[model samples]
Target: MSISTSAAPDTGRGPAEHDVRTQIIEAATAHFSHYGYDKTTVSDLAKAIGFSKAYIYKFFSSKQAIGEVICANCLGQIERDVLDALEGVQAPPERLRLLFTVIVASSLRLFFQDRRLYEIAVAAATDDWPSVQAYKHRIHQLVEEIIQAGRAAGVFESGTPLGNTSRAVYQVLVPYLNPVTLPHVSALHAEAPEALYQLVLRSLAPPA
Candidate 1:
């Protein structure tokens, strides 16, 4: 959940400067929520926040920069939720199932309940924003971790290299995870997670 302070305004380090940066982000998020990311502009944000466009520029280089922070925050919440759901679950099989279920549910909730914010997510994915790339890498790592644990427990076959297996599994989850792809597959949304999880489990099963 740690956002890179590198994105912070060049203003000197202090509580006051920090507050100003936060104010800009908060204001931008609210504006984007109301008007949608594509329709909003830095000038519009400055007007809303009562700061000049130049002042706002000191904090963020572009509209996408501000969106990146908001997108990171949203994706961070999903990662936290996934971690919380996995907490205290010792069984890799169950953990894998929960991972699929929780992520899909969380994503669907965001798409349905917060369409405006979801617009930002869609932009992030389409534009190949750094935050979205980092999120995908983390999710891939989580899958690899679960696969490694499964191998240790002898519940999953070790014949396939771990990297290949994990990547294959992650690819299967991409349609559900990628904001841009999720809507296209909406018809399968309800049943795909469980069906995919079973298919993955079978693939990972030890040979007879």
Candidate 2:
């Protein structure tokens, strides 16, 4: 999954307008971090940035629109981290392991380090935000790509349909990947990711 810029619809504005939009996003990020997303309103952001509510609306249609951009940015960083971890790893097994480990660690770091920003991710998942959906789709695509590579290398069995295998692997990852379920699983099964990763490797292995 590549790092995506923003999930919000592009306005096709000029550079000056784009600068204003970036300013609005940066201000909103700080405000959301300090005050929490649900507690803060667009009016609050306008005041914090010395812009009128009407002026803020020129950049974002609603508070949720601003939240979507922040959420996309957060998820994008996770994708970049995963890509970096997989760099120079030719083995499909190692690639799959890094994909699972890096994503879970990155998410946990976000939850602990910038918890308020993490709340935005929770809301995105709960509300079925487009950014969340797109993130999940990209993850699924990555899993499928790894599975294809493994099959081509004869590292994984080719009997199961590719789509089915990919979805199954993704399902195994959902508990860790989902913001809502992550804390719960982490609390109960801190070692679940490693255990699950090994299970997946065995399941994908070609018959003896």
Candidate 3:
């Protein structure tokens, strides 16, 4: 009886397929973050992770597929956090505070520590990626939902357009979430993220 000790290459299938896919995603995310999407290639990722190009191909049909997964993960995380903040919070004002605190802290972590991933995700999002756009729309909906809830609960003044305020908050916070943008905004406002968070809150604050 001959003993076969060589392990099979990853094919991204079967019961453990999810785990293999996750591994591939992690490796590809790091590569894309470091070298950027345009500069990074499937070959580079395979080489970096000691996997055969064929194995990677089996997992992801192309680099774009991997990028889609990364984008989905990023957006899903943000949605989850926002939803979590909204749940079990009675007061609309308190809900807004919780949401902003969670989001700002999360953004700070992503911008400062995982900047490469942030950059890669942001780039992928703007290049006509459908998944990216959908994810973004979901975030917009989250903001809109918060604004609507606040209005209905009488926490935000009536006649104020929640949609417009949602858009404003998104536009203002999105760019500042970038580390590069942080310094520029920080100098202007001093406390940067904190100030921006407060500014958004004040803008939405109900009368007196």
Candidate that scores best on lDDT: 1
lDDT of 2 by residue, 25-68 (tens): 88888888998999999999899889998887876778988888
How much is the lDDT of residue 130 in candidate 1? 88
lDDT of 3 by residue, 1-208 (tens): 1111111122223333366666777788778768777788889989988889888777776777777667666655655676787788877666666665676565554545666676656666457466656755666676677778878887676566767788987776666443345445534443455666678777887898
Model 3 pairs whose backbones collide: none
RMSD of each: 3.3, 2.8, 7.7
- Model 1 reaches what TM-score against the true structure? 0.90
Runs off by more than 4 Å, candidate 3? 1-19, 33-38, 48-55, 125-128, 177-183, 186-208
> What tens-digit string does per-residue lDDT give for candidate 1 at 23-83?
8778877888789999999999999989999887776778888888778777877888899
Q: What is the clash count for each candidate, in the order shown?
A: 0, 0, 0
lDDT agreement with native, every candidate: 0.84, 0.83, 0.64
C-alpha lDDT of residue 102 in model 2: 87
Give the candidate number with the greatest TM-score.
2
User: Model 1, stretches more than 4 Å misplaced?
Assistant: 1-17
